[model samples]
Target: MWTTLITLAIGAFGAVAAFWLGIPAPFLTGPAFLVTLCGISGIRVAIPARLRDVIFLIIGTNMGTAVTPEAVATAGKWPLSLIILSLCILAIFLIGARLLQMWFGMDRMSALLTATPGHLSFVIGLTDDLKADISRVTLISSLRVLTLTLLVPFIAPLLTGEPLPRLAPATQPMALPALAAILILATALGLLFQRLRVPAALLLGGMAVSSLAHAFSITEGSVPQWLSLPAFATMGALIGTRFGGVSFRMLAQAMGASATLSSFAAIVSLAGAYAVSQLFGIPIVTVLIAFAPGGLETMMAMSVLLDANPAYVAAHHVFRLVFLTLVLPIVVSRNR
Candidate 1:
């Protein structure tokens, strides 16, 4: 118990430091501290099994509640637009990855997958399986996320000065019965998805089920803001943990190539987003989050902080995630 308390305190302090230093919000302190604790003790601290479940549940619930019927209606009208935009983004990444591979003489699969700009772990795992250069891939992927997280929040404001509207705060206290129903439903959905081997099942499936409930007017209560705080913190900490095992020697070797790939990817993504924004008549911030090469948690936090449409931002990024995952292997194989 005492160890847990100490861990929590350290995590909080790290988060506070990051925030003060103008690090992107959704500060990830928990994972950072866990990594630190592991380093200090020379033993891995087992994350309570329940904690992982809770994190995914929270993520799923938040995502599920985010989408409203209105958002769906808007998406329906421009069905082909989202598809076209996603394909364009995927193509850009593939081309950029190939260029980097040729320039740096890096492993083709690793460079291609690292430039995917979606889930880092998934990309890393796939690259490793393909016997690609894990070190270079990991470095470039991490740098891509970090660069995007830092750049978008600063650049977005310049492009879209007017803050987006926020979700109105809940006024009435949530009834216990409604909250209980939501939990039960979300849990069942998450379990089903897990059983079915769905990707990020807990998050994606839970959110889908919860959103369906919301749309059907089965649950009108909003997710308690308190629940989201830890979820975001956990996400941030996990991102920071990626740095724990990295060495200066490895980073030094990869730095030039990583920087070049990251910069090129960012520029192309931003330009694609700009063109899409004009074509679709959507807000620029939405385009930015959709095309921004970073973690989902970081993008969502920026969406909230910038007062942009969280649902739009979430949808856009999710769209990209799905797109990249599906198209990357096919593109790489064809080109090879």
Candidate 2:
């Protein structure tokens, strides 16, 4: 309890720094940076696994509320586009993993996990379960996520040759009762998915239930801001704490490799975004945000900040995450 409070307080400071520095999605990114700094400096900071899972549930419910019938309709036209985009994203990780294997002399498991664009928590959890080189995988994955967070807003426009729109505040707010129902439904489904051994089950299950509720008109509007801020802070702390066991030398080396892979990923994301936009007639910025290899919250927050279609962005990210969960373990099994 005290530990959680201390972490959140530190995260609040990071959020302020990110805001003052004009970083996109300052609430998450800012705290992430500060906590990570403390983590590597030997400061004791932790968020228990149970608390982390609850935070995932909160974020999942929030993102799921973005899935209205209209959002579902928009996504319905995206099957082909999603297929192609998934292939491209898969190629990026495979090729990037190969590069890491060859250059860094890393084991197949470590390289593959490091190169994956799956959700950060999901990847970290898998690393622990698989007994992979957690230090290496954690460092590389953290660098990739942090790099994308800092770089995508600035570089995505250049890559897509499209200007970002001005920030517009989101207008939808779900009723408190409806929000409660969504949370209950998500928690129930999350337990079921966990029983089925699904990856990131809490998040995906909650998202599934929330999407269903909104798509069927059982509820409407987005998750309230009052609930969202703390969830975001919790997520930031989780990412920062992942640095706990990684050495500075290993982190430095991984950062160098992560920069190269991130550059490649940015180009792939840009090209894929352009192609998918042409195929589906969605806005380029929207496609880019959906396909960018950042965490779900970071990208969704960017959509809100840039006045892009948050629902559309959220849908694509949810799809990517669902797809990765189904496929990543299979890939890992084969590599082993």
Candidate 3:
């Protein structure tokens, strides 16, 4: 308990420092960088699971406000990009599996599970049931998310060549009564998705409810900054906690594997994004976010930060998860 508090304090310091330094996505990246250092240095850091869920719900609900009439009109442009996105995930999965097997000394099952993009909870469950090395999979996957979280902000700007737009939070925040009612409905639907084994259930539920409300003008304002700022910080801190209890030596052993897989997957994502951008006239960077092979929660949160098309980015990620769910077992079973 004390450790968690200390970790959060360190994370808070990181957030303040990043904001002071004018770093992009300060609230999200600051704590993540600092807490990750603390974690790698062998400190005990943690974010409670419930708090993590709150982060998801708030961010997801906030994302719903990005659904505008313009975004709706762009729906026609998404199918081509999504189709390219499907191919990108396949390339990442197949090449990543082979890369791990060839260079990292990981067995097929371990490599396959480690290389599979997104769906960490589902992959970990498979590791246990399939008798693969849980630690290796966890480490590699965590490293991927951490590395992307740290690198994307800096790298994405270079790729896009356009200054990020500043979209202020809504002037009027959601009413307390409406916020509470929305959360209750989101949580109820989230629980239903959880029972059905859906990935990012709480997030999707919040997004679904909020999107519907905003679409119909039932909800009048966005999630408040008071809630969102802390949520982003907590998210960054939670990301850093992914490395807690891991040794430097163990991390060193996995870094090469993680880096190789991460680079390859990123390349595939970039390529697909470029193709879609050409085909559809969408910003390459926005398409890149949609194609990024990272956690749905994290990527969606980043989308909110970047002010990308939430409906577009969220749709691709949700599709990626569904695609992975249906295809992973078949790929593994056939190979085995």
TM-score order, best first, reads 3, 2, 1
Candidate 3, lDDT over the whole model:
0.84
Error of 1 at 205 (Å): 2.8
Q: lDDT for each of the candidates?
A: 0.63, 0.76, 0.84
lDDT (0-100) at residue 130 of candidate 3? 82
TM-score of each: 0.80, 0.83, 0.95
Candidate 2, residue 309: Cα displacement in angstroms equals: 5.0
RMSD of 1: 4.1
When summed lDDT is taken over every stretch of 10 residues in candidate 3, the lowest stretch is 162-171
Superposition error at 164 for model 3 (Å): 3.1
Error of 1 at 26 (Å): 5.0
Q: State which candidate has the highest TM-score.
A: 3
Q: Which residue pairs clash in candidate 1?
A: 28-236, 28-237
- Model 2 lDDT, residue 61, Cα: 77
